[model samples]
Target: MFTPPPSPFPSKSSELSELEMTHDTPTHANPSAFPTHSCQSKQKYTLALRWTIILVPITLIAIGVSTRLFIHPTSFDALSPNSIHEWKTWSKSLTDWSLHERHKPTENSPWLAIVPGTNASPVIKRSTLSATPAPTVPINPTLPTPFPQPYDTTLSPNFSTTSCYNFFLNMTQTDALRSCRPFSLLLTRSQAFIQNQDDINATNIDIWGTCNTDLSSSQCDLNMAWFTSSLRSSCATDLSNQNAMAVSALIGLQAFDLMRQAACSVDPVANAYCYVEAVASSDASSYYFYQLPLGQALPQITSGACNSCTKSLMSMYSAALSSANATSLTGLQATYGDAATKLNNVCGSPYAQTSTVASSSAPPSVDLTSVGGTWAVLLAVGVLSTSMSS
Candidate 1:
């Protein structure tokens, strides 16, 4: 399979020897036939020199190839143009990695300009792209809220003490955490009562004065001008007994009412359930007034332009009124009307029954008979016309 190239020149030593042998062999008769020994030797020497020059280059090339294989036997096949380019790129990137720790190239890095072979001078210059920055994930806090947990009460005290858990515990004690059992929330309930007592004791005089105007003087009982004073005197313990859970439950009910009104006004009765869960789940306090599906829990209502909702329609409505720049009476009436309409629609038929017309309304039996007779007469007329046509 291997063939060696012919030498370009003959050996000078052999050529000289041949010339000497020829010279001694004959004195040729013809001058043309006679050969000069010196001349032949010189010609032979020149040819030999030429062959040596050519063969030396070939030998050197073969030695170089053999040395390369000996050094890197496995990578010999990868010596092609394409593979060499790839290896160069890889080596460059790897070298860059050590050089610049922060600016290391990634797999997602875009292709840059391409270098072409000698035959083509300039290759297409692609857009140079930097590596994507490391992702920065948000760290969520471990706090808990009325967001439903499993109904399991056997959780560790540490879990209950978490912010989220504490918030839910606070809610559950008030019936706001429907997922939690009432018995498990005794501590939170007690603490809520203590807090309420403090709030009650610190009631503002202005607020108390306002209550007096709405509440009857006779109803005040203890000669206190305001309902707050009456409660401080007689109903103090009663309200304190309510705990935070009851108050939360009351707020939840109000939120549910408001949501129901909003949903009904926007959608048909059939689609109302979608908004019911949505609006109910909008706030944790709202959870107390309604039950969630097995896996569903209420979400938190973030503070914003909207008023912070809690127990007591008067206060909740007042807050909403203040936030939106609406008068107190206007806000209360609007909210109440919406709640009443939704309640009426859900609990009763579409027709409103006025008390004045109760006795004057016709019985159902009479209407049914009348409608039946009308249909029978129409049927007889159709039969008679068909018989005449036949």
Candidate 2:
């Protein structure tokens, strides 16, 4: 029985051939494990890539928003008086008149002379006398006398709408003095006030004291009080016409300086008021200056130098507020509130009234363009992320 089993069994070579065939045949072959693992890894990589595309832009946007909210300067920061020293230096340069070099009088200058009964002072002679004399006459024959005619008390006609920027270009001091002679009284008064504060009270001057025809007595009184508060000294009851004119000129100049400083400030509301005051001061200066005899071809004085600056600042303010993201809105509001409070404290009832009127009438405007730009950026990022993920 054992011999029969051996005969039936295959040889060793045949067994080897059978094993090789089993290894090569598709049915018995082992499945490739690497392919399944590679496929799984590829799927994971694709999912991670899609998520990264969606998250990167959002993260970057969040960082940018945070930066604007926390890092950008607020209105209060921009308008803070901490930088007043820089502003003072800038103002000195901005207001320096080239005419002073040639026209300003020295002790030995011929412009200094004695009137018959009055003490010696700097003076500029007038070419003509008005038909009607001013309320007060100059005791000194050398001083430029006020117009004798009953000129319009309102500052409308005298304000120069034309810009005087060209006058300073290639202008000689002599030419400046000749052209600016209309403002001789103003210049003289400013110089005198600087030298001796006792000579004038800025509030009692004719230019400021003359109540507007449109204003009621109470309104006029309120205006007078506001003007008085801005003066270097308390309002004076005993101002002569000459002294009043000097005081008026001094006040106008001071107001101009204040507006200039405010133009450099960051507060929107304060900037607006300062711009208005600047324009008013310029009008007053020009009105009084033009009253003098036309000495030479000086450039026509226009509104204050802060006009362009004010517009620029207001535009910036609107743009910043409008562009501010939701995250930054609270901070910006707080900044504006602080600035408003400070302005109310400094400017008192005048600021309160004007701000109230402004707020009630037109309210603050936002720059839609800036807001749209922010939205456009976010939209673009979203679109890009969608496209990449798809």
Candidate 3:
């Protein structure tokens, strides 16, 4: 009787076959319910393939760019030839004019205070009202004594004697002496300018009336006093004391080199001759006033002496000259050459001659590190976006 009821249904074998078919075929009408293993694997592979297609090249490019940028960098000396030429031309013109004017003054002129072969120091009388009695202060016997007058006007009144003394106390003798060089130079140069009142007036043409002339002069004197006292007391290493005049000469040369740079920066075209004239005047004042006087104070400041100092000074000048871009190397060459010659005559030459001009034809260095890095990042982002979308 049960078999009879099952007669309406399929046979056992057919029923089994039907069940097998049903298991094999899709269950849902959409055909999505029974996904094949092969199909799923293929879909995953396609997604991976798409991402690989997008990201592989991006990764490669990023790596390539990063490598390039890390190698090369730009520097100030890498200016274009044309720019260098313009700078040299302008600087040379101004320098020429200045040199010509400088020579025009007669030996008897009051402005020409420092005679070439004589004592270079200017005869200055200390104001009785402001002069303090030399203090019987205890000083390091290892250091120089009877410190020179203030030269640098940039320092606090107590800087040389108090601040410098305190600061230099912790340093080695060599370091302390080296530190004093800049201050000594500034002081000597400033004093030289002050002594040459005519040179100061001429050089300060632009700033004289408008730039608070009276205050500047007073301040300058005050600063010089500070430097003079500091070098005498605080920076008074034995070596410095022995070679005080030599140190003064070396620093003076450095000041002259600095003045050349300042002069070069004066736009001859835009400012006409005024700016250049001012620069020249200022430079002359500094040289003849402070530097000459300081050098004259010691025996070592003369020519054929201070050989080490001359080398150091030449090195600094060479570095500065090498940094400028100009068509003609003549001006720079002449400037440093003249300086070297003067030093040789005054002190002596142990220093090698330096090339004053930069090569115009030198290939400009390209800094691609920045550009390459940027491209690498952009490509990486594209790869990431593709991966996410996939």
For every candidate, C-alpha RMSD to the true structure in Å: 36.7, 26.8, 22.5
Query: Better model by TM-score, 2 or 3?
Result: 3
Which candidate leads in TM-score?
3
Q: How do these models rank on TM-score, best leading?
A: 3, 2, 1
Q: lDDT score, residue 385, model 3?
A: 70
Q: Which is the winner by lDDT between candidate 1 and candidate 3? A: 3
**What is the alpha-carbon lDDT of model 3 when measured against the actual structure?**
0.37
Best-fitting candidate, scored by lDDT: 3
lDDT tens readout by residue for model 1, 1-390: 989997788889889998999767465566677578978778777766666565555543432233222322223223322334587654544333121111222334332222121111121211223211211211332222322222225423432124433443443343323322121121122232212212222112111221223334233222212322322333233335543323222222223323222222211333222222222232222322122111011122222112212222223333433453232122133333233232234334322222211121111122121232123334444554443344
TM-score of each: 0.15, 0.16, 0.20
Cα lDDT, all candidates: 0.30, 0.31, 0.37
Roughly what TM-score does model 1 have, to 2 decimal places?
0.15
Q: Tens digits of per-residue lDDT for model 2 on 228-257?
A: 343323223212223433244333332322
Model 1 root mean square deviation, Cα atoms: 36.7
Better of 1 and 3 by TM-score: 3
lDDT (10s digit) by residue, model 3, range 1-390: 344444676799998998999767554567655568988788877887777787776665544334323321122111222223577654544333111111222334343444231223343321122212221211222222212223433332332234344533332133223323233242333453333333323323322221222234334434434544554555455225444333443334334334322322322234322222322332232132222212232112343333333354455546655654221232233344444444555544444353453332222234343242335556677767766566
Q: Which stretches of candidate 2 lie over 4 Å from their true place?
A: 1-342, 350-359, 366-380
